[model samples]
Target chain A: MTRDIWKHLILVIGAIIVLAPFYMMLSYSFKSPGEIDRGTGGFFGRQEMMVDERCVQLRDPNRDEIAAAAPQYPGKSDREIRDAIMEEAAVACAMRPVVFNYTKAFIEAPLLRYLLNGVIVTVSIFVIQVLVALPAAYALAKLKFWGREAVFGLVLFCLLIPVHAIALPLYIILAKVGLTNTYAALVVPWTISVFGIFLMRQFFMTVPDDLIDAARMDGMTEFAIVWRVMLPTAVPALLAFAIFSIVAHWNDYFWPRIVVTGSRDLFTPPLGLREFKGDADGSFFGPMMATATIIVTPLIVAFLVAQRRFIEGITLTGMK
Target chain B: MAVIDAPVAARTSREVNRQARTAWGLTTPALALMFLILLVPVVVAGVLSFTNYSLGNSSFDWVGFKNYDRLLSRSTYEKMFIATFTYVVVVVPVSVALGLGAALLVNSLGRIGDVYKTIYFLPVMATLLAMAIVWEFMLHPTIGVINQTLELSCGTFLEAIRFFGNGCADGFPLWLGDRDYAIWVLCFIGVWQGFGFNMVLYLAGLTGVHRELYHAAEMDGVKSAWERFRLVTWPALGPTTVFVVTISCIRAFQVFDTVEAFWPQGGGPNKSTYVMMFAIFEKGVQQNLIGIGSAITMLFLVFVMFLTLIQRWLVERKVHY
Candidate 1:
């Protein structure tokens, strides 16, 4: 019992340190600027009404507007009319800090567009990887062919080349082709996933030859056998690869930072968040955290919902 | 009988030829892409390292061995090697140890250990850039939770420690800003983001350890937990240790996101956190010094491949038992 208690104590301490930044991120996302600055407001942050300073500035009434509001103010001075308009604008802009932060997170930059680009890039890369790697993995695993060992050898050698390490030359390639600042730049380099091919080949090796023989007896060609026979059996492995590929490409900052330079339309989520941080002042913490939370929430939530699968997918690399 | 068998054999050989054609057709795209994207870039980086190959240059003279020489002799490159190796050397062992420790602790607990496992793995799932930003805020010298909490312990008994006492007398060290603490802080974040992954791998390894061996060890009077660990657990975990260490070394060598997130302009205060990846990005991509960058890339590849080869050899030779 004493040992259990000590273990729990130590584990709980580790958990708190691990969880601190996440807690701070979510808390600040819900917090008013004042609360963030003062480092107060508990977990959900009082959710107190806060004015949008930018909105107030945008709605600041001019001389013509004060004159126009003069009728409503009756005998009030111009300054009083301006003050009344300002108060009304502040009131109109008043909202809970949480709402304000999230709205700003979506609106301040094209976060939705960045997210769309992320989805497009990840989905395209995964799909093309499956398309390219499946047939090759199937060939490598099942088919007896010339130079098969050489091809598999090349695959193993390519595994050592971390894509990030070769970013400069790849960037130069894309630049020479005038493809930088384009989706092609983001999606092209990752299309050939040797890891995916390797993983699928490993999975496919376990698939019995009898299955392919049965399909061939049914008049299936080699291509038909690869898709109709091997693909269904490869679903679990494919799902794991999908998760792995999606997470890596979605959170990838370096390659996109290199190729998608200066174009908002081409920015991935990380790049967009970095751009946000570049211009953000002190008061932008709430919105910045809100953006971070937004960017991080999808994967975290997906992992939470499918905890076992996520772990299995991520640790699949260790199985090598 | 000879005529009939010969025709059938010829037809079967035709089928085999068709099968070979299909196989080559299937692999052609991947092979082409592997050549263009993966294999070609290394060759390009090699050639570019020998020339003054800026992107926009119409023509450039060959620079011979000057780039490699500069990388060897330059102080900036020296700092880059030091920082990169320091991070790798410190982070690999520490994270591997922590991972093994966490795995053992978690594995000992039956069901409740799942909760700690989940919590620890959260960092591995979170985006490193976003988390780095949050950590930056948490390590903020004034309003950060760390310093504020330290201030709370100033007059308390917790200040009996020497570093804490001195900090309380003056102020807490600026964790990210201080030159001495910056690389260490980066290493801390690296370990934090990484160990959970190693722990998961170790846990998977732990499951593969046969239970009857433990019983046998117990029968042999491997009495204490430490003894059992030394006799049973450590040896069983040898392959996991090898893998976790190698992967951690590679990942540590590629430490860029957090460093870049914290110090966007320079590596760190006085270039203290100037790592290889950042140096590559700054000089090659940003400053258009492609030669030095490619040189670094080649060196980076050599170090990583060497570490992986060592791992392969160690796994094949020693850990096979």
Candidate 2:
């Protein structure tokens, strides 16, 4: 074995490319506005500047080193030095310092409230989806019925229409019902995902008929068989769909933007981040990144935990 | 026992039919929800396309194709069509090819396949709205790190030289701002974000391919790598390729967040990157032209359905069980 140096090298390169934007976001979140304005910084500096806790420290402590870094400015006084440092800190904090940005994100905007709203909407949608999808999938896969193929095919066909296509009509309906600016507007319309139904039906077909027959032999009803038997065995598929559903809704911006116009109180994390972009004519880069980090953190954590099942689910679909 | 089972057998058929009816009953709730949430919107959109519906308006004046006529007359609509079509053209092939390439590389490595998959899959998991904002700053004209790096690598002297400076005098591509380059940049970003997802699919498809096929090919004097791929690999991965192509095309057409964040003026800099989805979005949300927006959406729906049907017809005919 020659050790396949090229393979290892390619892997390393792939990893770097994948990590580049993240690394850049993390680093830029720490840099002062002045440093960003100048467009140059040491590759490895203090990472804490990206957070709000270390925002004030963004200013240079070493005047001599500062001069070396930027030879443009030299003289001045004690207070002047302090002001320059403060100014630099402000700018750096402006660019991003993770902690400061987060604090500002929470304080200047109703981010926490938005996050709570997101949680409610996301959870409610998921619960309703599983409830609706499970029984429907069981019937389609296990129970023989008239028009089964036609109905399932229709559901599959629905997947072709992009979400944007229905936004207008959905908005009108929601508006007519006086549901806009409320949680109902956000969650109710998304209760039944066609993709979820299709996915569950597909997975349900893989469940052995013998298992269902065995359950039925024990005097279990169809609903009981679905909830008690099929549901437990379909954990991997459910987890797979969970990742998809969570990511899709979590990152969704346009719908939320349209629906929750009157209530900043009910904004989701993405909407909250958009609002926190620039207020008072100055961009809150530090807080924005902090908010971005916080908003994205849960999704990243979810993926990390369920990665095995997620990959399996995706691959299974592909093979089909 | 055989004599006793005769009556039970007679009842079994009726029992099955009864079970089927109950099953259909259980399905009603989900079907209704789907109809209310998905189908109703589609039907309403179709009906609304023929009316002059807008926000804060009680009456819907029956316009009867006037909205469609008006939209078709607008230059922005034409530009949006071209931009969206171009985006689909560029994004589909590039993304599918890159995905397959990445999958092959990871599959060949064997042991660290999961690690490679995870790294690439991170972007797919990333929050797109937040990520788009991050990219905007990174692609900023003056202070962007990318521009600075290019300047550093090329050196200020080379940048100043007439040969290089003639086309790019501003020293860097105004990636988000320049109309001509914006769509291309958006396509690249879209591909970058999505390639990992399709890679995972291809990787799965590769694993399912029987190793004996390769052995047989090898026995047939297939020494060249391309020949092996053509004979042994391509046919096995047919489903995966069809899947990636169709899905990627559909997704590329729906791009909105990235372009919205990057080119905020609804694809400014001379109406360059104003894609169809964004046009529909702007119509409904920004302009509140509900009827017109509905019209555009119906058009998009018809277009996507037509494309999907054609693809299904092509792929389904060739699909192997």
Candidate 3:
């Protein structure tokens, strides 16, 4: 059991290295620019009130404003009135760093919109993938078909050509068809998940043929039996495939970067974060990390809540 | 009896025909989408590789093998090959080994290991682009926490090392900006993000290894842990390692998100991180050099297919089904 001490030591170090970036990302999302620059703020950072310089800049008093504020100042000098107004603007703009960072995460860009787009694209892709894969999987597994061997062979071949490799031709084809900058560009190419079909087909093969036959004997059509009998039995496999598809597409940057070039509305979370990094300056690091945290949190939280399933789902690809 | 047999045979033939029809009905959409999306693009890329076809251009001229010629002869493409292969070569083995190592360690720890498993796997779950951005921030030259931390080592005994001494004297390496460090940094990130996945796979494989085997080996006077592992565990993990290595290789080959995030304008300093995936995107999509991009795509597909074929061969021939 003492040998386990060394094992724990090694694992703890590995854990720290692995968790460092996550810690930094979360920490930066909380700290002010000053703290981040100096690299001095501890984990949650000092929650001191920091002025929103941009907001204060917008409120820089003009001559007419100073004259207008003169009355509120009573008999005070114009300069004093201006200082008072400026001080008021500073107070109005002041907020804690945590609020500043998270607010700007939403406000600086259409982060909420980007998040929605991510949901829309990832959901549509998963749903469509399941739809296309399930029946085909069912047929390949249960139904007797001419050229089933050929179809399955074709699938094995297609799996070799990773979609990212052939993205050039796909992009060209999409551009030719005027599908780029649309959700179709994001979702169309992924609709036929050959791996999903292959995995489900394998899973469906393990299912008892008698169950399908029982449905058929009840006068259920083959399609009906597939949806009613096979799909329900394939839930575990489907859940795994769903996790795999959603995670990949949700965090997908390369495809979305290619197709959804013009429209901000169409940008996925990854794309939006990339754009944030693209234009980010030193002061903007806080919001950028906040954006990173936001973009990454959903999946990480999901992974944490259901660690076993998430791991199973992600590694299901390895079953090949 | 002959009349009855004939009717039964005829009825079965009709049923077979009906099942085939239904099968076709079910499989048609998948086949059509697969052909349109997957198979057709490979063919299109094959054809497009020989031509100077941009996206918007209606007409283009064929230059047979010319695009590939550039890929072979040009220095930039040379860098691209160097970078891509360097990433795959370095990341694959290291990550696979790390994964195997981590898996073994975690397996021994029992329930306490689950925490480590979750922590290591966090990188696999986090959006890689976001993490890449964070890494870039930490690797920033002057103001980054890495350099700031290194500066802390200035007055320490650690300064005896050249890297640290140089930092104390001149400056620490600009990790993403330095050609020497850029690719390696990317490789480190690749391992960090990837090994956890392989670890998980190996953990699953471990559960399938018979517990009785270890006890039997012990009874046979298998004295040391190393001997036990070498005799029992390693052999049991053969198929899993094969699968893990192949998957890791394919993943390492497709390392784009981090590279693209790190250096959006060019590949890294001196094109050290110019992986094939990024090269395809840059040449074909961004630069509108479709022919050249398609050429790279063809090469990439060949590499991937070759690896997968090798894995299948090993799985069939060496590993018992």
Candidate 4:
């Protein structure tokens, strides 16, 4: 037990370093701009009220409004009336720092739309990958076919081509087709995951020939067997691959950054956070961190919930 | 290829042909997509690397070896190669070592080590761009948590050290902005983000090491744990080490997300962190210089494929294990 104490000591320190950014991100999201600038407050901030400068700025009184506000203070000069109206605007905009940070995060950018686009792209990519991969994996694993070796060899060859390395031609192709700014450019290149084909083929290799033979005896067509028999048996690996695909495409910033140039509505979470950072000044730090926190929370939460599957999924891909 | 068909004499030729047809039907989509998406890109990049091609241009002159020559001669491209090789060189060994070390430490503690494993793996699971942004904030020169914490050590006895004293008297280093510190900071984050992955792989490798080898080594008078590891664990982990090192190299070579996030303008202070992936993105996608980008892409593919082939060779040889 005493010897174990030192091991625990080292691991605890590593944990602190690993968790530091997360700690900062969450803390900054809660902090007011003043607290963030001065670097005070504990994990969660004091929740003190702060005014939204932009909100108040937009409500700045013009000449006609100051003249119309003469009813409330008939004897007062226009400057005094404007001062009182400005104070009222400030009071009206006052809210807790947490509310200010979160609201501005959504309002200042289309964060929800970005998250939705992230979902759409990742889901469509994974579905298409499975649609294209599973049948080929089925053919490679179980079917007695000519050119099987050549096909598997081609898959192996394709595995050597890192998709990111060839982004130039992919981008050019998308541009040639006038699909550069569309979702098709984001989804099309990744539709064929050679790694997926390779992985599923490996997993399918372990299943018994007798199980597949039994399905054949039931008068099932080969397509039905693929969708029904092999698919069920391959669930554990497929689950891992699903998490793997989602995490990768969801967090993918490069391809989306390349293709989704002009459209804010089409931006993924990473691109949205990046665009937010582009426009943010010092005073926007709280809201910017808030944007980051929201962007990262879903997968982190899912990971904390099912860490085993996430770890297995992530590491399993390295087998390629 | 003929071997699998040898046993098919027992089956009818019609059934065999039916099976082959089904297989072709099933694999055609994947094959076509693979050809278009994967293979054709290589052919395109290879063909276009010999020419000065842009997206909208109708005519492109063949510029044989010029792109490669510029890559060899130009100072900017020279910095790109240096920065890239430097990152791969530093990141691969350090992260692999940290990974193996952490794996050993965590594996020894049994179930209690899972907390550390989970914590370490968090960086891998979370979005790297989001984390990179957070890191940017943390590495802020003035009000960042790192400098703020460093300021705490100002008047302490630790200031007797020159680096810490320099940090104390003057301001702490401007991490991302300072050229001297930028690449190393990026490398540091790369290690921090990536070692967890290698640690996970190492932990998996550790499980495959048989229990009786240690017992056998102990019976053979291996007194220290280091000797046991040197004899039994290291040899047993030979395959895993090769795999971890190769994957780390590929990943290290493709270190773009952090580099792009940190130094989007010119690939860091004076292009100190100008990695190849960023170079491709900058030249091809950003500037529409397809010729240079294709050249860099071809070179990147060669390096990656070469590393992969070496790993495949090593695994096939089973040299140590």
Going through the candidates in order, the fraction of native interface contacts each one reproduces equals 0.71, 0.73, 0.91, 0.82
Q: Compute DockQ for each candidate against the true complex.
A: 0.82, 0.50, 0.89, 0.84
Query: What does candidate 3's lDDT look like per residue over B282-304, in tens digits?
Result: 99999999999999999999999
lDDT of 3 by residue, A208-248 (tens): 88887888789999888888888888889889889999999
What's the best-to-worst order under lDDT?
4, 1, 3, 2
TM-score of model 4's chain A, to 2 decimals?
0.96
User: How close to the true structure is residue A7 of candidate 1, measured as C-alpha lDDT?
Assistant: 93
Model 4's TM-score against the true structure: 0.97
Candidate No. with top DockQ: 3
- Stretches of candidate 2 off by over 4 Å are A1-3, A7-14, A40-98, A278-283, A313-319, B1-17, B154-169, B319-321
Interface RMSD of 3: 0.8
lDDT of 1 by residue, B103-131 (tens): 88999998999999998999999899999
How high is the DockQ of candidate 4? 0.84
Candidate 1: misplaced stretches above 4 Å?
Answer: B318-321
lDDT (Cα, 0-100) at B311 in candidate 3: 93
Residue pairs in clash, model 3: none
Comparison by DockQ, 1 against 3, better one: 3
Error of 2 at B118 (Å): 1.7
| TM-scores for all predictions | 0.98, 0.87, 0.98, 0.97
1 versus 4: better lDDT goes to: 4
